[model samples]
Target: MGAWGISTFDNDDAADWLADLSDHQSLALVRETIAAALDADDYLEAPEASTALAACELIAAAIGRPSAAARKQETLTRWIAHRKPSPDTALIADALRAIDRVLGPESELRELWEETEDYAAWQADVVQLRSRLSH
Candidate 1:
């Protein structure tokens, strides 16, 4: 959990995942990441959760609702310019559902954040991500 801030792409896992996404330029990776989180039957790991959130952020960007932080990332910006992903409604719904799972009690990422004084801030970031995905 190499996190500097609570924004979607602020962790090592997310950054690495984004790099992979940029390299592959595949929207299926984003969908798969979100599905991984949503399909988890046991406790979701922090890295998985982080990556899912990053996937959600990508979906938001595809729909012209990128967060300020996401818009600043060179790789993500470049990927968006090149791929031009147009996420369907199902992907958006799945991203939203994955976000819910990440925020839920069974999530290691959520549990880890609960121990910090910045839990509220982290939660707010997730809520903002969900909001962005909603539209």
Candidate 2:
């Protein structure tokens, strides 16, 4: 999945999704991405999982809880600065649920990470993202 690290935006799918998000600057896109993961009835693909995580990162940033890596993303930072969106409680709660689905057994992202030595670190990164959304 072209992953270099465990941070939400440290992968190809997420990077691409972030680029789209930056260009469009649409909160509805963010909601749709998270819902893609949260509402999936079958096994979730790695790319979809990655995109959802990126969407959750945006939600966290909108709620004034950006991760260190998120702050370093120039495009995302610019988008956030431009939009200044304030996510409500429902979106945050859905983000949290989307995170859970990404980390769940049906997620191909989690399955792929399980085969790597960095599995724990990847899981930790996702948990940290969830923590950011929780508050």
Model 2 residue 54 distance off true place after TM-score fit, in angstroms? 0.3
lDDT of 2 at 56: 90
Q: Write the per-residue lDDT of candidate 1 for residues 21-99, one digit (tens) a residue.
A: 8667568899889989988888899889999999998889889999898999899989989988889999999999999
Q: Which portions of model 2 show Cα errors greater than 4 Å?
A: none
| 46-77 per-residue lDDT for model 2 (tens digits) | 99999999999988887788899999999888
**Candidate 2 has which clashing residue pairs, if any?**
none
Instruction: Report, for every candidate in turn, its global Cα lDDT versus the true structure.
Output: 0.89, 0.88
lDDT of 1 at 132: 82
After superposition, which runs of candidate 1 have C-alpha atoms over 4 Å from their true positions? none
Model 2's number of clashes is: 0
Per-model TM-score versus the true fold: 0.95, 0.95
Worst 10 residues of 1 by lDDT: 1-10
